[model samples]
Target: MATLSPEMPKSDDRKSSKDVVAKLNYVGEMHDRAVYDIRNPAGSNIVWDTRDVTIHDVRPHLDKFTMDTQGFAFVKLPSKFAENPELFEGNRKARHFVTDDSLDVQYAQEICDYIQNMTGARDVFPRLGGLVMRTSTRASAEKAAWAPPAEFVHLDFAPQAMQGWIDKTLAAKPRDLKPYSRVQLFQAWRCISPGPQDNTLAICDGDTVSSDDKVIVDSMTGDPSIPGNRWDSRMCHYSPDHRWYYMPDMEPDDLVLFKGYDSDVPDAMNAMHSAFQNPLGQTGVPRKSIEARILAFYD
Candidate 1:
């Protein structure tokens, strides 16, 4: 059973303190299992539960959060779109992402290069299919066929699922794959919208989460008729020990990189994150964001 925190901040402190109090959805204990249908939420049948918790602003403690320690890191990475917004304006649309355009391909390569430089990896592979745009509003999400900001606390992939991805990726290569000393999967997220986002992502400190706290759930995406649309992800049961942090009023240039799996380290930190409503209340601009998955190999 998950223990509830007795030190939950008061309503006044939540608004005035450095930390913000917000509601985060987690897997309910009532259900022995759960399944999330990403394409069709109406078809999802499971318990959806929420809890009010304090989320600390990470800016002041940026040095403490690193991929090697807390499983996530925040950095200032200027995008080419920022330098010349007009040139790549069309690339923002979901339709352009359907078939990789030259602009999209360039942007993807930029991300790959950045990751390789940051991690000092032998190589970095960007999963083009993993690139996605999300919005906080329903209308934008529906219009673009883009996913909404996920409101639940969960990690992207389980260990077995990550291994499966590694296998498939290697098998598709034209040449034989070489053995690697280490492998790490990462998700890079950035807010494309304006600052003071009404909804921002909150990540739990990996060190605070216990193995038993995670519950494997099926994530179903794409067409229901497809056979390979499902994969295993991890959802959490509430634990008072969980420490959550978020970057408040993030700008377009700010990028967050979090790890999903690590092959070398035992009990490696895996960032568990969710989008939460801002305790300070809504801003004029809703949250618009993009995320990509990248795999890094170290020899």
Candidate 2:
């Protein structure tokens, strides 16, 4: 059961018994764990980047990592990694996400070049024939009872943004791939709630707006009928076309290659969706309910 919110009384929670009903006029659902998007930093209501809060991932040695002025932070693997695995294991960060516009273009290009080199596609960029990303989705990955299943790992891939990136890459021509001289990228997100379509979100009610604004794919995971998060409860990532879709659950720093070019992947994703049918009977990932009582009860 959700803890009562401090914002208001239990009986006057107004929207739902599970909600706290903050003083804000909106009668939206509420729950500390009832998921929301973190794309806009305001979600946390906490200022500063990841460093502002020292909850987890605090550093004993700041010198071992690199954080430039643009807020692009990452650590390169040294040649001595194989020779000294114990010391070099912890300081590495895989994805140096370009979170700020004012960052230097050279830094982004440098990181991209490093990624290309690591992918074993040495000359694909800088004067490239082209770049291609083939994608595939594995449905019901949670059903398998593997001893090391992916319940704990971050669900880092969102489907909508992934499609957006796919569209972006396909439109570009085989231009001379100079180091990105004008590094500009548009960011947007849609707060998708699961509905009739598979993996696609329906606008809450009467909303019709979309743009380069950051999107919040408010995803639901695990079995939908169940009240709480199950083994598969998670949020995924979607990018237009980035070097690493996501690293595997292997080592802390081992960036695994995702198969982004397979044509049959999208069809497989639709087959498992819980539409029309009730989620209680669904065998795999549960569907979020739209019933007035079920939907708005949890924020």
Candidate 3:
């Protein structure tokens, strides 16, 4: 169960003294289990369970936050992506990023190289990557060529899904001769804006989350019929001990690295994350960002 407050914090409130509103996944209904069918092409007939809105005083708990402890870290790295910014143009890939264009493929590969150097992984493989833009309604945002910020408490992959992805994605690679026994999946996120972000990302401490609080669900692409297996994503039930943190005034050069799945130990499990509404954000220009999902093999 979660500790909730009815009071909401104002935009001008101080970070150390104020509370922030969080839209959390609520799963106390009288159902055998929670599941939704997301297999639709026109962005119609989508079934996303309703979430509960609650105000929380995150200031006091901010002291407990850390990348290793929370499964996320804020790292500063300057990149030359602005020289080829058009690589993210169009929704041709739709919903999620599809790597078809040669330029887009090159861009993803470059990101994979960056991840390898950042994490010092023995080997890194570039997987699916995409740009998410904030536009229109929150519900309709994912279907847009430029998607909206995902405003919910969730993890990108489940254990089952993570295993399947590893077996399939690395089947052709040479066997590991090193003593490393596991693989880790990471998502590198960054802002593409010229200034500070009004809507920013929030991360939850994975250590505080128990197995029972995680609800595994399928995430279907816009076209549900092509490759029928549903992609796995975990919806989190709120808890009082769950600590959340975010980086304020982010620039394009800074990257937010987070663990999506780790095969080695429970302590290094996936990071729970969501985008929150920052009242202090500057208006007129929406937030633009890109996220790259990469796999790192450990020794």
Candidate 4:
């Protein structure tokens, strides 16, 4: 039931202005229903371009993933950008981040016996982060895993900061491994959301807008050969301004929900990347030697 557009000849011109906003709203807001209806069902789903995507249909998926006294929900929308929907192919760098929280996650039944009857998101899930990695063509897996010179080292950040910290790690990584940005990693690990804060509202990314084109999901070709193409959902992933906690995986109907992370390098991420290739490190450079150089420069 989605709105469709006069088709564009190529991928670049495919989306209209409303398409962009719809994609954004989807990534930001759609995933909150798990908390809103922890004990019930979502009123509507924005997919099908007409908001035809409904929570009632998703209930079965929730029933499958829910755990004892808790569960999780996921809303998959179309990609915001049409250039490419698959983020899984390439030499990828992936990590997890819990940037913000949604209001429902805060007041839900998982938290406190004292704080209303709803469960607190923090108690049900805490420090949840996603596992993400860029992808490469089927061919790249054979490359001897890209490695940095002896001077650099690899370290995992606290789960919540993995995505943010990845920028730091990459800048420090060798130029040979730069392609890691393209691959998108899949994270089904467990975790919970941090409590709600001033920025509790979440953001979303969607492929098409309900108001834009009524026929958004329809295809002229009807190419059954195209594996992921026939569907109307957008391929991109992103979340809102709310902060979240990175944790391992949990069960269904639990108020904890999930959405995709915004894929971009932040400032903290860039700084980390900068340190990777500083002049101080080379083939024979001792780890301590390079660390000393970086320390001196920063000091």
Question: For this target, which candidate reaches the highest TM-score against the unseen true structure?
Answer: 1
After best superposition, candidate 4 residue 190: deviation in angstroms? Answer: 2.6
lDDT of 3 by residue, 19-134 (tens): 45545544443334444443343542323444434444344454444545567665555666622546455432454444556554555566677667656778787554344444
Q: Quote the lDDT for 20 in model 3.
A: 54
Number of the top-ranking candidate, with lDDT as the measure: 1
Clashes counted in candidate 4 amount to 82
Worst 10 residues of 1 by lDDT: 1-10
Query: What's the true lDDT of residue 237 in model 4?
Result: 20
User: Candidate 2 — what's its lDDT?
Assistant: 0.20
lDDT per model vs. reference: 0.70, 0.20, 0.58, 0.20
Say which prediction, candidate 2 or candidate 3, comes out ahead on TM-score: 3
Q: Tell me each candidate's TM-score.
A: 0.83, 0.23, 0.72, 0.18
| Model 1 stretches with alpha carbons more than 4 Å out | 1-18, 30-32, 82-101, 138-145, 170-176, 224-228, 266-269
Ranking by TM-score: 1, 3, 2, 4
* Model 2 lDDT-worst window of ten: 290-299
Which residue pairs does candidate 1 place in steric collision? none
